[model samples]
Target: MKIGDPLNRSTDHGPQNHKAHLDKLLEFCQMGIKEGATLVYGGKQVQRPGFFFEPTVFTDVQDHMYIAKEESFGPIMIVSKFKTGEVDDVLRRANATEYGLASGVFTRDISKALYVSERLNAGTVFINTYNKTDVATPFGGFKQSGFGKDLGQEALNEYLKTKAVTIEY
Candidate 1:
């Protein structure tokens, strides 16, 4: 889907938040190219008004690639193919990141799915589905992704203070 004026209900998507963010996303795209990751799809600015950038996709990504290491926070997907039975290796690579906001595991094997969910450093792990969040569920990240959480009871705690009281009769 191409980016267009977000005000239009027909538009599937819109531009980045601002120019700086757009520039950063562009930089990541270039870094993906420079780091030898195969660009499978869009990687250029839309050349229109606002900070529009193409939704990008990169395949054959390496662990050391910038696209693989850092979070672009943009409409970019980096795919790293692994050996058929190398779940441990994949988990290690996924957890090696400094940011641990979210992760997803898609598999028919229940045991494998649970194992990956247990080992991933991200705070949220989606099995079989992606980006499924609810107001009742706490959402946040681990490591450098930031502290505390948002939504759910956990988020409510952030703005509340607990006080202990004792009564003697």
Candidate 2:
């Protein structure tokens, strides 16, 4: 789903499912923190009842690090600042990972956005937005992230078999 709304960021102790999911997410987040990514925010789990966790952010993340390279699949975000004119740097960092399911480009320059969009080795690219989704769009990852597309018309092709029809004319 496209995550346009403001996320809890921290573990939501108010909800049971939120706590459970946040707990698993915490493990992944801390792993990244330990690996050297800066913990910009939300590093600790709430001591009170429920699965309340702090909303965490990581900065100064290196591209080679496990946290920066892997998909956290959580509320955590690792941000790396880049120069104003150097879009290529960000593109390289974003495309450096093994997983290439989707990516986002935020810029005012249309040409730069298009250039990065075209150069990025991902199946899906969104300009100026992150985690945007559509019912008609296909979603999946490349390399070790796994194979096959989910949702949309591409989903129908997953179980389909191609047959060659031959006739003597």
Candidate 3:
């Protein structure tokens, strides 16, 4: 297995709340996995002896699939290809989802990287890293993914309300 192989399932698995439609999630993953995407890691319903999944990856995934549109909580990744010099294509695909949490752009071209970082429609855009977090940075989801910021100093502001009191002196 590689350093980030999907087959290396986490042992801390358990029943998750079906707040986001489990059937839809499964369907999305299946559609992507079936469309030439290799299931390298996770696609199991039950852990059996342990709460672990196969940790899967789907390479060569096709666009317009549900997996590409939705977010998977497990260790499932879909690697898709786009035309060279077609940054717009990637941008469109990346922004097609209702969820806008975090995104990353990896490239040597500084201009292209900056452009993508500015236009990804995500709350946090990392130029060359995914899941880079900081206590001083604001974090939140957009659209159906939910709202309200968390982390950093700004987190406290979200839970606060301001009021102006009038007094006659």
- Listed in order, each prediction's TM-score against the native is 0.80, 0.67, 0.70
Clashing pairs in 2: 11-53, 41-56, 42-55
Model 1 has how many clashing residue pairs?
0
With candidate 1 superimposed using the best TM-score fit, by how many Å does residue 124's alpha carbon deviate from the native? Answer: 1.7
Q: After superposition, how far is residue 137 of candidate 3 from its true place, in Å?
A: 2.2
- All-Cα superposition RMSD per candidate: 2.9, 5.6, 5.1
Better of 2 and 3 by lDDT: 2
In candidate 3, where is summed lDDT lowest over 10 consecutive residues?
1-10
Per-residue C-alpha lDDT of model 2 across residues 20-114, encoded as one tens digit per residue: 67767777677877877778777666566655556567888877777777775555656776676777787877877877766667778888789
Predicted structure with the largest TM-score when compared to the true one? 1
Which is the leading candidate under lDDT?
Answer: 1
Q: lDDT of each structure?
A: 0.86, 0.71, 0.67
lDDT of 1 by residue, 1-169 (tens): 7479889966766999999998999899989899899899998889887888898889989888888899987788777766658988888888888998887777888888898899999989999876667899999999998799999999998999899999999
- Could you tell which candidate, 1 or 3, scores higher by TM-score? 1
Ranking by lDDT: 1, 2, 3
